[model samples]
Target: MPVWTLYGIRRGIATTSWPEKEGPTQPGVLGLPHYHADRCQDNCRACADVCLPGALSFESCEAEERLALDYGKCIGCQLCTEACPNDALTKSNDWAFGVRNRDDLIWTEALQSPPAEEVTRKIQKYFGRSLHVRHVDAGSCNGCESELQALNNPYYNLHRLGIFFTPSPRFADLLLVTGPVTYAMQGPLRETYNAMPEPRWVMAMGACAVSGGASGGGYSCGHGVEEFLPVDIYVPGCPPNPAAMIHALLLLLNRASQHVQGGQVAH
Candidate 1:
C-alpha cells in the first residue's frame, strides 16, 4: 500500500460532524459583541467612538436616540467592548454567525432584527446535493484565505459534505469572496462573477468581504462585496472560521436551516 494511503487509514475519518451533531469548538475564537443597553449610560457614545469599522453608531430615531451595531461591518476587533465605560458592549465566545439577508445584520435598540430569510427549494433544485465554489481574494490580508483553505483540510474535509472549491468560475455554482474588494480587483471580481454558470450565488465570507472590515471607508477599498455584487449570504468575523463559512454555504443551498440570529447561536 502507498505510504499516503497508510497514513490516511491510520488517521481514520477526520471530518467534523456538525449541524447534525456536536463538533469540536475552537478555543479563543471571538464572536459578535453582546449588547446590554441597560448598562449603557444615557449620554454615552464611547463604544461608537472607538469602533474602527463604524459598526457601532449612535443614531437618532423618531422616538429616541439609539445605538446601532452592524454585524456585517464588524471585524471583531473588540475595541468597542474595551472602550465601553458602562459595559454596554462585551466580548462573546459564540463564533457561529451566518445570515441570509443583509438587513439581518443591522441591529438597533428599538428594532429587533428579523431572522435570516430561508433558502427556497428553488436553490436546492439547482445546486442542493452538491456545490462548487470559486473563491476570489479581492484584497485580503490572507486571514480569510487561510480559513478558506482550512475547509479542505482533513479536520474539516469539506468534500465529505459534497462541497468543493474549483479553480474555474465557469464550473462554479457559488462565488466565495474574501477581502474588502479593492479598486484594483473590482473589474476582475465582476468578470469572475459574470463567468460563473447560471443559478449562481455569492457569499461574503468575512468582515472584509462583508463590509470592508478594518479597511472600510478607505479611499482605495470598496465598502464591501455587496456594494458591487449581489450577495446571497453574509458571514461575519474578522476571518470567519470554516464552520461558520460552511453554515452559510449550507444555508444558501437549502441543505440546512439557519441557527444563528442577531449574532447569537439559537442552537
Candidate 2:
C-alpha cells in the first residue's frame, strides 16, 4: 500500500475520537438581521412588497400612526431597507442570527451585538498572529463578493482581527475562494493555488464554492471544489452570511474541527 494512503487511514481512526472530546460544536453558519426605525418613512411599503419569502410585513396602527415590521417572515434580503424612500430601515453587521424555534426569525430590533472582543481574540490565536488571504471567484453570481467587500467596512472592520486580503496569489497565506467551480474557472483556480507558497490554507466560502450548490450537476459546473483543490474549510450556505464567513475564517486559523468529519481529508 502507498505510504500516504496508509498514513491517511491511520490518522482518520485516531482523529475519529474528536467531537466526543471537544466541546459542543459551534454552528457552521449564522444570519443576524437588524432594523433601524429612525431611517424609516411611513410612506414606503416596498419592503413588504419586495420580500420574496413573505418575511416582512406591516400592520397599520391608527393610534400610533406607523407601520410595524413583521420580524418573523424576514429573509434578511435588506431589499426593503434599501428601497425605503426615507432610508428608515437599515441592516447591521451582526450575523449570529440563530433561534431555538422557527418563529424566532423575526427581529423586533437588532439582535445582541456579536462578541467582537472574543472573536478578535480567537482570530489572533488561530492564524498565528498575522494573516493574509487571497480571494478567488470560482464561478459566483457576485453576491459573495459584495458581502466580502463589506467586511472592510467600519462596522465589521475585518482588519482588526489581523486579517488582510492580498491582490496577488503569490503573497497570500490563505485562499478565500467563492462560488461553484465552473469549467472555465477550473484552470484559473488551479493556477492560483499553485502560485501560493507552502504552508497555505484554503477556505471554500459560500454554498456554491463548498458543494457546487445550485450549480452542482449543471452543464457548466466543474462538479465541486474538491475536484480542483484541497479545501481546508467549508463555509456552507448560498453566499453565506458574512458573519458565517468570518467564523469559518477564524476556525481555519484556530484549526476548528470541521462539521462533516472525515468527509474530505486535507491534502
Candidate 3:
C-alpha cells in the first residue's frame, strides 16, 4: 500500500471510537448570556438597546429588579452581557440549547438525545455497523465543503464518528450535499439522487440547500434542495460550522432508525 493509504488506515482506526463518547465541542458553540450589575449604572441600556436580534431586553422599576434575559432569541452572543458598565453580566459555559417548544426556548436545559445510543445500535444492526457517505457540491462557494473536508483533519476527526465519505454513489448510504441547486447543476443533482440505491439518505447542508440561501431570489437559481431531492436532514446555516455539521450528522445517524420507518424527516 502507498504511504498515504497506510496513514489513512491508521488514522481511521485511531479515530473510530468517537461515537462511543460525548463528542468534542463544535465550533461556534452557543454560550449562556452573562450580566454584570455593578458596572451598570442603571441608565446604561446599551446591551438591550443595541441588540439587533432582540435576544436581550430590560425593564426598569422603582425598586431593584433583575434584567430579563430571553433565552429563546439569545444566539449566546455575550454582547448585552458584555456591554454592561458595571460588569453585571457574564455567560455560563453551558452549550446545550434543546427545547420542547418554540416558547420553551425562553429558558435553558440539558441537551437531550433522540435516544442516540439506541438509534445508533439500531442503525448498526441494519446498516452493518459502518457508514459510507458521498458528498455532492450542487453549487456553493466551497466554504461548506471546505469545513466538510476539515472533518477528516486531526482536530475534528470525523471517522471517529463511524463516518466515511465515498466517491461513488453506489457505495454510499448517505448523500451529504452542500450548496443551492443551481440551474446548471439540477440535472446532475437529480441523476445523483436517482443513482443511489434504495434505503439511501440525503442530508442538505448549509442555508443554500435549505432555502436557496443568498441566491434564493436569483433568476438562475433552482429554489432549494427540496425542489430536486428529498432531504433526510436539513442542516441550516449560511455555512454552518463543522461542529454544527457533525451534530447534524449525528442527529441524522440517530434518526436512521426512523428512516427505516415511513414518513419524511425534516429538520
Candidate 4:
C-alpha cells in the first residue's frame, strides 16, 4: 500500500462530525462582517463606499439614514470591517449564512418564507434520505468551484451524508449551481433544469450564483440564478467554505435549522 494510505490508517478518521456537533473552521478564515448599529458613527458611509458589490448601501429612513447590509451580495472580503472607523462592522466567522429565502440574507427587511412544515415535508417526501446533485457553472470565476471540490475530501467526506454529485441531470434530485448566469449559458442552464425530473430543487451556491456578485446585471450576465431558475436555497459567500456548503445542503433537506435571519449571524 502507499505511504499515504498507511499514514491515513495511523491517523484514524479524518472526517468531521459537524452540524451534529461543533467543529473548527479554518483559522483566520474571514466570513461576513457584522454591523453593530449602536456603534455606527453618524454621517459615515465608509463601509458602503468601499463595498464593490453593493452589499453595503445607505438606506434612507424617515429623518435618519442607516446602512443596509445584504449578505447575498457580500463576498466576505472584510473590506467593510476595515473601512469602519467606529468598529461597527467587525469581521466574523459567520460563514453559514445560507437560507431558503433571499430576504433572510438582507439586513433591512423581514420576509418570511413558506412554512417549514409544508416545504420541508414535501422535500423529504420526494427526496427521502438520499440526494443526488448536479452542479452547473453558469458564469464563474472558478472560485466557487474550488471550494466545492473540498466537499469530497477526507475532511468533509460528503458521501457519508448520502448526498452525492452526479454527472447527469436526469439522475439529480437537486441542481446545485455556482456563478452568475451568463448570456451564453442561459439556454444550457434551462436545458439542464428541464432534463431533471419533477420534485427537483435548485440551489444558488455563492455570491456570484446568488446575486451575480461584482458582475451582477452586467452586459454579459444576469443577476445570478434567481433571475431565471427557481432557487430553493440561496447560500451567500464569495466561495462559501466546505462546512457552509454542507450546512446549506442539510438545510435544504430540513436536517438543519437556519441560524441566520435578516443578515444576522447567531455564532
What does candidate 2's lDDT look like per residue over 106-213, in tens digits?
343433323212223444454666689999998887988998997776545677677899999998988888877888888999999999987777777765665565
The model with the greatest lDDT is 4
Error of 1 at 223 (Å): 0.5
Report the C-alpha lDDT of model 3 over 63-161, residue by residue, as the tens digit.
Answer: 664455444344444666667666666654443322212232232222332322342345556665467888889888787889898889876787766
Write the residue-wise lDDT of candidate 4 on 1-267 in tens digits. 579978879999888778667868577788888878889887889888999999988878998988888899999888889889999999887788778888889885443443333355878776658899999999888888888889999888989898999999999999998888999999999999999998889999999999989877868889899989899999999889888999989888888878787677655
lDDT of 3: 0.60
Error of 3 at 165 (Å): 0.5
**TM-score for all predictions?**
0.91, 0.52, 0.57, 0.92
Order of models, best lDDT first: 4, 1, 3, 2
For 39-135, candidate 1 gives per-residue lDDT tens digits of 8786688888888888888778887778877888888888889989888888987666778877767764444676556656678787778999999
Q: Number of clashing pairs, model 4?
A: 0
Per-residue lDDT for 244 in model 1?
A: 85
**Where does model 3 exceed 4 Å of error?**
1-124, 255-267
Displacement of residue 146 (Cα, Å) in model 3 is: 0.8
Give the 10-residue window scoring lowest on summed lDDT in candidate 3. 258-267
CA RMSD, predictions in order = 2.2, 16.7, 8.7, 2.2
